[model samples]
Target: MSSNDKLPQLAAALRFSVLAYAMAYGVSAHAASEAVELNTLSVQSSVIGTSEEKDVAKYPGNRTVLSQEQLKKTAATSIDGALQHVPGVKVQDETGTGVLPNVSVRGLSGSRSERAQFLMDGVPLTLAPYGHTGQSVFPATFNTLDRIDVVRGGAAVQYGPNNVGGVINLVTKPIPNQWETQISNRISAYEDSDNLMNNLYLRSGGWLSDDFGIQFSANTLNGDSYREHSDTDVTNFDIKADWLISDSQELQAFIQRYNSDMEMPGALSPTAYEADRQQSQRLNDDYEATATRWHVKYLQDLDWGNSAQLEVLTFGHHDTRNFVWGFNTAGGHWADPAQPSTDIRNSPREFNVYGVEPKLSMSFGSQDTLTQNLILGMRYVYEDVDYRLRQTNINTGAVTVPRDWGLKTDAVAAYVSDELGFMNGRLKVTPGVRFESIHMNFEDRNSGATDSNQINEVLPGITAAYNVTDEWVAYANAQKSLRAPQIAQVRGAGDEEGEVSWNYELGARFTKGQSSFNAALFQVDYKDQLQWQSATQTFANIGETRHQGIELSGRYATQNVPGLSLGLAYTYLDATSEAEGPNKGNELPYASKHQVSWDATYDFSGYLSTLSGFYYSDAYSDNANTVEEDATGATGKIPSYMVWNFNVSKELYQQNNTTLSVDFSVNNLLDEEYYFRGVDTSPVGRYPGLGRSYNVTANLTF
Candidate 1:
């Protein structure tokens, strides 16, 4: 029993079988204190941060709320697998399809990715008719979310200047409250027992009176390649509607579609891709992607007496995406093998984007004793981009022309926030500010090159909270964030700029009855940032960087439990880079200086259910430790490992309602093999992780 004592005896026998199935599912103790007052109230935020409900008492920064039963027990299949359980987030994949997964949160990666800011249902999925650059490759699944509002550090006065490293709304799901219908299905590795994932889902909702409402959902999935010619097929659709023309007025609408097809595996040299993850190969090339989104919203509420209140909202979105990416350099052996030339690299690429965004919000209050609370907002955006690259003339393979290019942008914003309450409401204070502007362009349909640029920004925030009872809360915050550039960081040339950050936070929150806790300690200070030059495609900015941190989360429900539950999370990070060239003090490249996660679940007494989990991380760097590897060098860092996953589930039903479920998982399950991302100087090293995988999912409901 040496693998770390079999993972703490499998996490104490799954926490004593979920505390004996929550004491035989009688779940009492005042229904776990009314489920902790419905898990800290506050329903909708008018579509992402600041619609009202004072978004966590005035919203100043660092938010994280995932409900819908924590996104249906993380049975996620998109939207980056539901944000990988939030908490510094990280999801990487250069291949194996999953449409180019690589979404970093606190540590931001790639083109410096204008640091987070993804919203839907309040639009802002990078604005402009869903304009691309959420690091396109069409990766964002969770079928069509129901909840996921994670705002971490500097939201730049609530999403402005492309927020510098935080904010992801997604919300979706609502409209149910009556007439309902559902169906679900899942079957893995269909025949052969080894790799044939399948999934399906359908949903419906109702409410055609007293205000009107509607909802719809659809999903599909097909798989056979976690890796091996990397196969995949996915589809999704969603729709929502609502209208309430009384007590103030409201309107809403949303539509979404997503599609995927993958089969690319092009980098292999880190010891032959860790020997193809220890011989689990089928590498190939060629991929596909598609996306669509549409949205509309309108809201109004007014009353200007002592209970002063007024609001207005507007939104519109349309996004279309298409894709194809390359790689198959004759199975590796570069050193001028024409530098990755599987016949000059059979190419096929295309990227397109279109965008639009509109918004407005307002609020005020004053009655007597200490009024407290005020908010203001504004937004407008437009975008268009299309890029194509096609090459295949090695020995006349045809298709040698298409290398078009395009880009366009126009953005605007304004913001204001205030919320001060001296006690009575248990003290709270918040200050906010926002201002942004942008106009960027780049076109080159065959040497007819064009360029344009313009930028402006101002962001600010301040927060304070002191409840210290009635379920505790104590907070402090400071914010300022910005990110612009990116029309390819400003066009047909190079000069990169558009990154800035400044965030500070101190937090605590606790809820009694069924226990709950949250903690925060963040510090960010960055500027210019954006590096990746050292054998490069050119890019630099480095200069002063930091990301100190601490995050702790908790959950409990075993007070003589019912269906049992327990959750835990811990994070401690320390990123560096003090400018002055060559990565000042190193670090910061794939973060991870300690991370932990734990989970336990149980729901017996029929339908069976059991869950187990464990995750730990601590290791980093793939570059920016000031490069160096040979030349007697040796400096790439990267070595770090800690993985374990487990799952079990069961549910069956037929006779027409047809509900069926069966899940079994074991990822990395103590295999200890490592390297999930990060490898420099191509030679495709480090990419293992995925040994010991056995997932069998089967869900069917109607």
Candidate 2:
């Protein structure tokens, strides 16, 4: 049967599920309200509990935490900008505003960040975590985040399937203990342009009583990018509530809404790029999206006296996205320099996802003896997606629908891990395993074609950490990871298998009075890796690939110059394919060999100033490793580039209950020219990068 015939049943099921969840939670809240109030204590509910320096030191792998202070010092307007400071992380700037993110870690493909797992407040951020891993529609805003935690290894047992690259968790702001209000605004403009961009943020929260608290935050952006005809508008709002039922029980919930619309300045041909890089060739290309999401978590402290705890989390979201672009018949791509077409094509997609997870943690034994900690968890997720494409004749004012399809996915996963401590708690080792079962079905409404697949896998991992001294630690880990075939791949003719990989890492960290350093060497052995075929617009299984890299980072404070701090991060990667194809033994596309970043900050009294620079080596745009530039500017070697930034901020007033501050920043201080190929939407031409820009911001708090 066609998916159109099952719409009513799906709608009914969704409504019933939402109603049941609300009713159950409503009763629990009422019961808690009648209980006696107790002293309130902060809770650690995220996957990485309480992302503090001390907590990170004990983890048996490489980890980095960007604190609130560091975020402020960077003065980054987008999450992509903030991540540039981390070693082994690559961010491709498709849009200057960072409305869409293309991030990669450890030389993995950065296309839509499909190789990495992204989480918001410990919940999956992609449209469908198992069915569709690509992040085509992202609703996160930098201003709403409190911090970012990145884990490079030792996370596969707890999170999967696309965790070969790493895990990135975005933590949001928490409710304040007392009443508070804040407002901030920033305006930015580019060089040699009159266009201006405006960003506004508002946050207000407070504790209504000892047991209940609520917070609300909103961020809006309206601006023009560095390129012509690239205007963007985005708005995000969220509300969070915390209910402290008792000293041992707590409930937290949040609801968020996001909407965005942006124009796509299509890529430029070689000749067009040389003429004017920032000019838009395709006028009718644009993107629009909207999303509504919510999540609820409950924590219970077990009475087993062994420091046992139980956590239950439930989350859901509905998202819709529409992409419209002009098709060039002469050039056989989206846009052509020789001939630009008026024929328009629109692809609209809608997705719905719901999930529930329950976890239990406990500890046994004492410090004098061998201590052990155990964790057991289970998760279930459901996803439904609808895709449609329509073509329009601009001259005739007529439209036709050519394609329509639907997909449904159901996945279940269970995991268990135990950590054993020896040598008076100085050495720790953890062993874990995870099992996943997934089923997917796809149906074409127009052609009456149907396809289905099922996948079952078991992943295992082990990690060890040793404390060499009071301020030094060494860690090593090995893990197996997997990525299921996407919905589109399943619908093709060939039978696709899930991609699998084995990852290894060795790292050490040191921290003393005024210095800290971290280093890690990592390698990945990937099997059945997928590669995109531009001619067929499908993916093929490429066998036997390897990625090896080393990351280094350090920070120090100089005693000679009070309040002066210096930081540096560097990465070197080698990625190659061993498949029996034409591209065998070739380096992966978009994977640069070297990357570096350095920053210096100085504080004088209450004033602060910072300067930073970033550089990346050249890379190829295709698996063939083409060196010469093609006519369309698609297949070529990208040129190396470097950029610098400067920021200064000062507090103008700080009194009893009010504070005021101002900041100014200049990005791309050197005004370097750079471009990228093989980007989404316009993969056949050169895409220009951001040029020199300046921003000024003012903030008020009470």
Candidate 3:
């Protein structure tokens, strides 16, 4: 390298040395503080659990944290709207209202968001790992989150199964030291719709006693969506309490509940869609969901320099949907494209699930120069399900032919992990392993059929990191991740096999001044790829599959324009089924080959402005690689598309702990005409993308 290059490197190294010295001194000098803040993303300790907050720089995994400030840039109404800007992540607009999003990471399937683990304050938010909606997860409301933490690789070893793709933790707002209340409301405009979107939120918290505090919140979402007959009404309630037993012990508890009801406009036929994208014929389709959750945790400081914690969580969910769908099938084919009599089905499902987990964490070191963190955990989960299906008799206009199914499941898991650091924390390594045992029983009372299955698996992971300089770091990781077999495959998972993958990744991060950059390359090899067959309603463990991708994300502050910054996130994926499969060399279904999201932000004069857009490459919807649409209303490919969005917000009040703000945003600025998803074997041919819309928000806090 040239001397000019060496000069920059030398300067960076010197700066890192000085900063390290300062941070080390601060750690030793302020040993009594609650937590030491190293950066925006990292902390010396946390209050949520036993491990506290560790240094983000020292963690070897590929992770990202979107802070509250970043979230305000767009003031997103849906999780999908916010996560769309993240590289290596896919967020599909399933219901167009953010009520139901298919979010996946690292090219994994996200049909129902079952490809990854979703957490709330580091707790599992999902129940059954099999079936269609069996493994669904929920974490309060999107507007209530203070931040989001994402780990792309090796999260399975530390968190357990269902993390093969990644882990997403929605961090909630904490209670303030003093009493406070906040109210927020929003009104939005939709395409070809007279009814406006109305949303309301209220949050309150205060210290009830010298040693106790509590936080409570309620939110509601109602009114018209972007499409006809797609109106929605949903409400959420949350309560959290924190009690301090002593200076060394603390207890925390949380409860949340929600009820949602909505009308699904259903899909538009090809002719109808071509005429007017907003047209819909299935007006009677409806969906309803209700859920409740409870959590409790206790933390103890064992004095000297060690701590331990215990935690438990349980939740129940019920989902019901009655829809008349599909265009073509063996028994029923639509002649008019708008009416399919045989496709009418009413399905109502109920799930009662509970889980408990206990974990212990220990910290050991001498003067903080060298430190080792160890964690041991055990988990138990149980779930019961009741599903009933009834078909409508078109001739008689009455319900007929009923099918009822029941299921029970149990899961046991254990894990141990260690984080070892040396060389004054310049280098660190993390090693972990997990064991899981699962049992399931299913019965079809109407058909007199029963099935039982059990499966066990072990997984391991390791990661290493080197902080070469304050401005630069390098990391590498290898991990094994697993996805539990679907309910259809569970009949013989013991003799057959579940989906598994081995992931390898290497990455680097650099930061200078107000600019930061990250780049990573990863490859995941699957042993048994579960291929879903729509015709048979079953999941088959196919041969091998490989997914490799390069992810890039960065931020740059303009030198001449203060408060102006540019951000970029891009991904390139090569996801293919192994050559041994019947569809060898073909790209995985719905796995886009390229994706890019960009943003420009300006913050000044108490006003924050943002402009953002995303582009996605065309993707196949099935393994068969069929491109032409069949007579059955199934298409082979989803076309490529791009979407643009804009937002601007300003603070109206700011004094002490009281504040108020207002913001406005527009999505699909260009009125782009496109399809979000395509299917080759499905009854519906395509799902059109969301159209242009406008949103206005007002928030108050005191």
Candidate 4:
């Protein structure tokens, strides 16, 4: 009934569930006659095809899946935080409060964000109605996600493009048959801050003869400044309903709302280091963001004996963001002559997207003949962005006029893919093509011009796989992708062009009982790549850049030992840009050459039933052409470092269904002193990596 008493009940429930699942695992044979007895607590391979093991091997590109188990064991405070464990991914912090961090894959930058797609529950997270820009930010409070899928390479043609780097898909929790709730609380000693995170989820469906179902979830996260001025409070609510219209059809709808306000620590300089990590906090700077999303999806089994299915989905989102900040001098002093003025901005955006896809498959030869499958789809999206900016000069006490602008974009695309299975399904080949078009219109309320531009592209992909045996598979693929020019470029304010990317890859997967491994070697080529020159604060067209690398990943879980798991991944990248411009044939700015990640976990079968693990990452940079710092080394070369972590959960009360977990983590475990990027000639440093810190967390689930 009370907050203190809730966690124990949840812990009991989790204990009971884990006991039941473990019992089932022991009694039920892996070669059972019926299904594996799926339940909420059972972990399944979430890859595309069947089990997670097969899922890893079925892809022709590099991919990683962060299971709920893994998500719970790490300090995944944001989308970037959740993905930092994956190889080839680097999270950059432009703001201290985790509000505006930039996520980059391989060696790409933010300007080419369109090359990567972000998704929530299989839907594009883009505020761009057409879903072309492929950009979206998830709230740091979205810690309730079920899983996240990170796919690498241009293999994203299956989900639609701008996917040169691939796609990041965040899957929400599914409706469970019973009531559930959780509360996660954590405090920081250094910053003297605490966070209370809570979630309540409910599901009911079988009452209608298993034909209908409904689910709802509500979550809240409240916290104060972890440092001097970093603070955030956010809330989100989601609801979903499913109706089995008949044996051949189903209808589903979902809605979600998120709101939050976060403090802005602004950027810091090297001279501010004496203030210490926890004591150094900024003031009078903050940003607020809100979003509402809705979706409806319908699936129908074709009349042709359920050999085919048609799916139609519609999605919409409304988002608003506001930011306010002012310049501050060092040493907590405001009387500096060089300090700048205050700035304020508001951005509002709306997006609507819909699509329909039909797929058909035919079998032959009694599990031996060649099988054929085809998928046809069409999608349309539209979005509008409006922004207003106002500023004032604090030093001169001068007022600045307000400026407003709105940009509208529309997109349409059609695609078809065919899959052929030969040699008794041992050899699978898939070929797909997409034709897409985009149009952008920009209007400036106080400007003298309204500008518009249109562009079209045809892209193709081919993948082939050979099943060397039931436990092994080898595959190769080639894909093409393109990113449309930004709407600002159409206004003639910048020199920007559409970017085209080509990706070629070869990979293999091996599954041996409880152990699985997957690896991919790829070369990504870009033409007319976009790069920015900080000296002039302008954009330029770099002729070409290449990202070539090999990715290796493996996992092993043993039932014989019961509750022990191990996983490892490594990515080696040689990213370089060749251009006729000033920095020709130089290493692409900020692209790291090597990355590694490894984790090991063991669960004790005693009453405590403890789980513990560790993780590490190598060093990387923020610029492609390392020219900033020539004093120690090249300009963009960020020093490398590693970190470690541990977590444990125990069951307290079984009858009440309660579980409790305590986590201890150390980031930058070695106190690695390094900056992501900084100026060698000046005293100012940009984006210093957080120093070593320890965090203890407690979570109660029922």
Quantify all predictions' global Cα lDDT against the true fold. Answer: 0.55, 0.81, 0.69, 0.58
TM-score, per-candidate, Cα-based = 0.32, 0.92, 0.87, 0.81
Write down the RMSD of candidate 4 (Cα, Å): 10.6
Clash counts for all predictions: 26, 0, 2, 26
- lDDT at 697, model 1: 59
Candidate 2's displacement at residue 692, Å, is: 0.7
- Give the least accurate 10-residue stretch of model 3, judged by summed lDDT: 39-48
Give candidates' CA RMSD values in order.
24.2, 4.1, 11.0, 10.6
lDDT of 4 by residue, 1-702 (tens): 122443464355345434433332322122211112222111111114321323565565667778776776554545556676787776654433344556677877743244456767777776562423634335334455778888875354556656777777777776554555566655433322343222222222222346666766666655543355656667777777777665555667888888877665543443453344333223445667788888776555442321444556667677776656553433333312124434332333433333333322222222356565566666666566665565556556665546666666667677776676788778978788888787767677777467666768888988888899888889888888777665444454443456788888898888787688888898889886665666766456665888888888888988887777787778888877666756566666556677777666776663222222223333334334443443322233455655444445454444565666666554445555545542111112334555544555666766
Relative to the true structure, candidate 1 reaches a TM of 0.32
Ranking by TM-score: 2, 3, 4, 1
| Cα lDDT for residue 440, candidate 3 | 70
Candidate order (lDDT): 2, 3, 4, 1
lDDT of 3 at 86: 77
- Most TM-score-accurate candidate: 2
- Report the lDDT tens digits of candidate 3 across residue range 1-702: 222533453455345434433332312211121422221111222212222122334456566667676676754667787788778888767566677667878778776677767777777666564433333334357778887777787566667677777777788888888998989988888767676888888899988887899999988889978877778888889998988665545567888887778876655667777878776566656767777777766544433244323222233344333333333233544423455644456666676655656555556674257766676676666666666777765555666557787767677788887777788677878788888887777677787777776778888888888889977889888988777765545542233456788998899888677677888899989878766656766656765778998999998996888889898989999988884656898888778899998989988776789988889899887777767655434556778899998889989889988888899888888889887543211236456788888889899988
Q: Model 2, 552-667: lDDT tens per residue?
A: 98989878888798989999989888788898889988888899998899997868998987888998888899999978787989988888988889999999879999989988
Rate residue 255 of model 2 by lDDT: 97
